[model samples]
Target: MDQPGLATAATQLCGISHPVFQAGMAGIACPELAAAVSETGGLGHLGALRLPPAALARQIAETRALTDRPFGINLVHRGGPAMFEHLLAIAIKARPRAISLFYGDFARVIPRIRAAGIVAMVQVGSVAEARKAVADGADMLIAQGVEAGGHLRGQVGLMALVPAVVDVAGGRPVLAAGAITDPRVVRAALALGAAGVWCGTVFAAARESNAHPAYRQRLVEADTDMPRYRRGLSYGWPWGTPHRAIPGRGGLNPWRLMGGGLRRGDKSALAGRLSLYAGQGVGQIHDSLPAAEIVARLVAGLRTGSDSPPSPQGQEA
Candidate 1:
């Protein structure tokens, strides 16, 4: 937790020791995973997109019990204004270190978040979105490149998108998101002017994540090109919006058969049909490790070979 050399303004803003942020993969990132990362000095996040009020509150309490260190909750604003407001109310009452928001307009809610003494973070896909988030009074911005897994926010790749967003961040810490699967990539993100990194795919396979065993196996077996970005047709989500997922046998994903009916921790065969959301860097990840070890390896590159990398067998150190 005393990794001062790896600290960035973004990490400082979140009060975490390292600049690694575990992406709030809705229905995937669990309290255990978030707590482990936070305890290890990186920022862990509870994905609150699919949770009910009671579940979200319970998760907040569970995370608190696991670690006294700071953690955050992630909510998707585009889900619905009323639901967003309801979740925001719960988040403000629970008062996590920060709340990271994605999709829709952040301006309408950043004020209340800041007023509640919570750091406001917005994830944007394009430079225009970055400017809007900055103007909306966001404390931090996550530049999500098209190479990222799950729902894509921007069509630009990480290499071209990060610096552009950084330039327009209005001095707010900007975190690079996409295929941040290894420490070397983390270092490259910093070189691109990103204050930190927000990672999702790699962490979704963490030992403690809520990702089903089938999904984890798919990630381990996946190649860089296995994931394909397609319109959100199966889910009850808007048809125009695109999301990335690894196809199952015969290039078919079971999620296409169910619409908004899946829940986390469901161990049935239907659980195997859950969309395997992952980044292009899935090839580099081959094993499930503790969230803390993953955090250690991700920050190891910041030392520039001065320190030995974490000894995780399946992943690139």
Candidate 2:
């Protein structure tokens, strides 16, 4: 396995060259970053969160121009029905190779996507959810563990969740997400029956990501056991969704200043106050590099366990 070929079903189901996935990280997974991953023989995904309709269209067009390889976009299905409709229209117009939905009535949405001849996948945190998704005509399932960054739906760890989901899925392809930045972890997930790996925090720290400088730097310097939190930042974001991220430390106070979000003035400034979402696997990220290099390193890491330290060009890890 020196070349670490695609040994999982994800490569064929998703029409990609590798079994690695770049998690759609909302405002962070920009077009350049997504395209970079696609160019490197892995599936790239644009995070379709908080982006305007026109902006989302532009992002899709831009990414398409970069690479003709099949890619995807992630959309949150838990929002208002009206919002979902509007976003769904935009998504159908973009015509991505695949669409992954999280946190909503996927049963209802899957049909609409299938009508458009698009492969639809659901991100689920439990075996029940996985079973429901497959029954509802989902093409694939992403088993998201609690260690995932951003909004998480359940409390199961990747170590225990993958096999259970796989068993319940009953031959349906399952991708394991959450804290899978390490190559060894990738190998383990595959061993546990995952066909691929969904990664976010590490990609957010990549050079092509749109993460704020402070946020990216925080990920690099973070620890695996640095008292992680399961609450989302209470700035202007919806209050009920649970997210796993590192609290601000050092000079970076990630907590919004008291009454800071009250000012609707500069939305840009408002975005800066929110905490950086990170998975426990962040400790494995030592340097920020291009998306392709990151994918290569992860793939190589899965193929060969090099004892050398990670270099700026992450492929050497």
Candidate 3:
């Protein structure tokens, strides 16, 4: 069987051979994982949200050292305008193939990215956000549904959100994200007019990822009961936005525990108790294979129908 022909905006925007993208997962995304995906003909993303300017530069350099293939940098949009300027400065120096922005406006940075000959991709969780991103000159729009892990902006599921964003984007390319762990979903995204798919949880278990062993194991052992709300963990995100993750022992339901009366002390306590950070698709993950191997399997899975269940082996802590 041949790989499914599911091309979208990613192909034209970033020159990636495949429409599959490795979402920029904070803490786990690194040069090794990004470069490996790029080498395998998919778009790889490096999360620069927590890195200092110097560290971001070093990571970009490191990725370049591994492969000259096209890769992108993810910038959390809420980090203020200065963060954009700083990221732009580094992007100018690194000259990445693409730059993805999420959780903030892209008006100021889009032009700079385009001026630097880099494609600008914006991640949007709502129809309003998608239209705004297009108006702001984003070359590609990632329609991230609420089913996605990490910081979600709205409650729309991928099945409905992808088509909505695609319609709002006009002629622009749209990438579908959220709980897309199966090839059939990949096919569905394309059918919904998405040019590609951006996956985060699928690669969290990759060997090149920096996720803690315990975290990876939790993802593998995840069940339908795994929590995917923001109130469970504390990472200074006061927005109370919903995020997906596997719930561990001592995990408190932010809603039930806080009971709408949150205090500074409560925030502190919750931060320490909850594991925080992960996607609902965690249950689909099985092992910590090399980035290359993960990509190969995804490509293979798309090409041939494999009845074998996903491996349940857990990585060592």
Error of 1 at 300 (Å): 0.7
TM-score of each: 0.91, 0.88, 0.84
Considering summed lDDT, which 10 consecutive residues are worst modelled in model 3? 256-265
Clash pairs (backbone) in predicted model 3: 8-195
Per-residue lDDT value at 40 in model 2: 85
User: Per model, how many backbone clashes are there?
Assistant: 0, 0, 1
What's model 1's overall lDDT?
Answer: 0.82
Report every candidate's CA lDDT. 0.82, 0.77, 0.72
Off by over 4 Å in 2: 1-4, 232-236, 250-273, 305-317
Q: In candidate 2, what are the lDDT values of residues 29-70, reduced to their tens digit?
A: 888888988888888898886677788889999999999988
What lDDT, from 0 to 1, does candidate 2 have? 0.77
- Check candidate 1 and list the clashing pairs: none
The candidate maximizing TM-score is 1
lDDT of 1 by residue, 142-243 (tens): 999998888888899999999999899878899999988877788789989999889998988788888777667777778888877766564546776777
Higher TM-score: candidate 2 or 3?
A: 2
Model 1 spans > 4 angstroms off: 1-5, 234-236, 251-264, 271-274, 305-317
